[model samples]
Target: MRIYKVGGAVRDRLLGKPVTDIDWVVVGTTTEEMLAKGFRPVGADFPVFLHPKSGEEYALARTERKSGRGYGGFTFHASPEVTLEEDLIRRDLTINAMAEDDQQNLTDPYHGQRDLEARVLRHVSPAFAEDPLRVLRVARFAARYAELGFNVAPETLELMRQLSESGELEALTAERSWKEISRALMEDQPQVFLEVLRACGALRVLMPEVDALFGVPQPEAHHPEIDTGVHTLSVLEQAARHEQPLTVRWACLLHDLGKGLTPEEEWPRHIAHEFNGLKLIKAVNERFKAPRDCQELALLVGEYHTHGHRALELKPSTLLELLQSFDVYRRPQRFEEFIAACEMDARGRKGLEQRSYPQADYLRGAATAARSVAVQPLLEKGFKGPELGEAIKRERLKALKVYKEST
Candidate 1:
């Protein structure tokens, strides 16, 4: 058996990036050969083994044929006869299809190295359309390499559009789709992920709530971008620029979804879009099987992001209520994420990216003041039961009042 370092490790290495993990493709190997050589058999759908020493995955060189619909509807053939070239042709992108031999020699049967040097994300074969999941994967790769000036080949995007129109994207599993989306959100140009998806019409199938925002108008006075969809993408871009955590990025992405639900007569003014957006955010969570933390933060941001922007104008009682709504005392980290999401929204408008968001600092101060209303002091005062809860609330409200007055 011959081992070749393959996939992301080889691709990243060629791009002069620090390889995080190494995957190996074994040629001229059978399952019995791997097991006899001390490799642990681990694959479920195909022949994959774990290295006895390094613990890295070693998948036997295999070929796949589309037998039905969706990504899962594929037949795999892994035999000692399968060539390395046959395996590489099955990959989604040209940049990811190349493999490196143990002697560090490159194998480019599909011209992956050429596409990588050209900064293009091209499909390895026409069979790219066979897997609906490749649409999301291609968009994710665009997001990952966007900072490096890489773009999806126009032909690849056209193929994605065909896949989208074929209604195959709807067959993708929620967990699988979320994996690509969350990873894309963490990339350097997360907005490009949405843009590419939208360009190919996959966004409408996978996330209609977000897709609805594209043509929806927002108050141009506040959002120089004018389009709610554009504004949302801007928010995601801002979150990525800050290198915010996944929770914050998710919140930013869903924050303006309500604007799409506004009455058309209302046009530019989405008076209660925050409250209107809560249902859409919840629907997105339900569709994607989003994590509780992501759904909770998105819900909070959807329902209260406007309150954050109007923080200075809100009554002291309202400020305390907002802080209480987020359970800031117990989950201060989440509250921080909420503020960061709101700040990203405020700065996401066209030509305002560098503008200051004093609301963040103001809310932070309010939270600090509210938390400073020590529960120890109330406990020492013999407060207990329902009355204790009321007492703590009163103290927090009072402290928040003082903070509000100072601000």
Candidate 2:
């Protein structure tokens, strides 16, 4: 059996980037033979094994034909006759279809190297449309390589549009879609992923709320971008630029869903949109099965992000209510992430990318002030049971009042 390094390992190496993991494709190998050689079987749908020493995945060279719908609908053929070229051709992108031999000889049957040099993201074959997941994968690759000036080939994007319209994208399971969406959200240019998806008509299929934001108007004074959709992407981009965590990024993406529901008669004004968007954020969170932390943070940011922006102007009692809503006493990091998401929204305007967000510091100070109130003092004063709870709340409010006055 001949084993060759394949997929992202070879692609990243060719781009002069770091390779985090290595995938091996083995040709001329049988399941029985692989089992006899000490590789542990792992692949449920196909013949894939884990190396006994390195623990890296080594999948047998195989070919698959579409047998049903969605990404999992496929029948695979793996045998001694299955060639490495056949396996490589089934990859989603040309740049990901190259392989390297033990001698470090690169094989480019699909001209992946050429596309790499050209800085284009092209499909390996028409089979690209067979799997709906490729649409997200291509968009993700676009996001990852956007800073490198790489773009999806026009023809490939056309195929993506076709796939988006074919009703196939809807067949993809939400969990699988979330896997791609969350990963793209963490990429260097997360907004590009959404943009490419929108360009190829997939955004409406995948994230209709976000897609609806396009063409929707916003107050030009506050959002120089004017288009709510453009501003949403700008906020997501700001989340990535600040190297914010995934929860914050996810919050940035969904925080403006209510704005999309604004009545056109109202034009640029979306009063009480935060409350209007709470349900939409919950819908998105449930749709993707986002992590509990991510869901909680998204909801908090969606409903109270305006409160974050109005931090300095809020009454002390209101400030304490906001802090209590975040449960900041026990989970301060989530509070910090919430503030970061709000800051991203504030900075996502057309010409305000570098503008200061004093709201963040003000909110942090309020949280600190509330936390500074000692519960031990109330205990010493004979405050007990539910009365102690009231006393602690009163003291915290007093501290926040002092902080507000000082600010």
TM-score of each: 0.97, 0.99
Best by TM-score: 2
* Clash pairs, model 2 backbone: none
Query: lDDT by residue for model 1 over 1-407, one digit each (tens)?
Result: 88898989999999999999898999998999899999998858879989899898999999999998887999999999999999999999988898988789999898888998999999999999999999999999999999899998999999999999998988888999899999999999999999999999999999999999988987778888999999999999999999899999999999988888888998988988888899999999999998999999999999998899998899989998999899998999999999999999999999999999888899999999998987888899899999999999999888988888887
Worst 10 residues of 2 by lDDT: 43-52
Error of 1 at 138 (Å): 0.4
Q: In model 1, which regions exceed 4 Å deviation? A: 380-382
Clashes per model (N, Cα, C within 3 A)? 0, 0
lDDT score for candidate 1 against the true structure: 0.92
lDDT of each: 0.92, 0.94
